[model samples]
Target: SVSVLSYAVIFAASTKLDITRKDSIKFICTFAILELVIELLYISYYERKKMISLLKGEK
Candidate 1:
């Protein structure tokens, strides 16, 4: 949602901001990659915590 809003704002202001199509694509792609990386880190952390809890239960 935020990404879309930002994209919309960038596009709406593109003419005034003198932003090129290539730059806009790059910005959107960067945001997507960063979001994916963050999501993966969170998932990894949750899985590790779950495994630790399971191991503790086996004691």
Candidate 2:
């Protein structure tokens, strides 16, 4: 899953930087928020195109 992969990457980076758990969690949360926004945009675009195609097919 992307969530697991993202968390794993964050933890690895944090360890490399010698940061604390708090900082790592903060980065993970920010990344999740950004991912949500991007996912929404992607879904919206995909659905819009699909509906347009279906409408065209009906006509």
Q: Give one digit per residue, the lDDT tens place, for model 2 in 1-46.
A: 9789878987898878977889888988898899899999999999
Candidate 1 pairs with clashing backbones: none
Cα error of candidate 2 at position 26, Å: 1.0
lDDT digits (tens) for residues 2-26 of candidate 1: 8779767756665466678788778
Let me know the TM-score candidate 2 reaches against the reference structure.
0.77
**RMSD (CA, angstroms), candidate 1:** 3.3
Model 2 regions more than 4 Å off: none
TM-score of each: 0.71, 0.77
Task: Evaluate candidate 2 by giving its C-alpha RMSD to the native, one decimal.
Answer: 2.2
Q: Which candidate number has the best TM-score? A: 2
Q: Look at candidate 1 and tell me the lDDT of residue 10.
A: 59
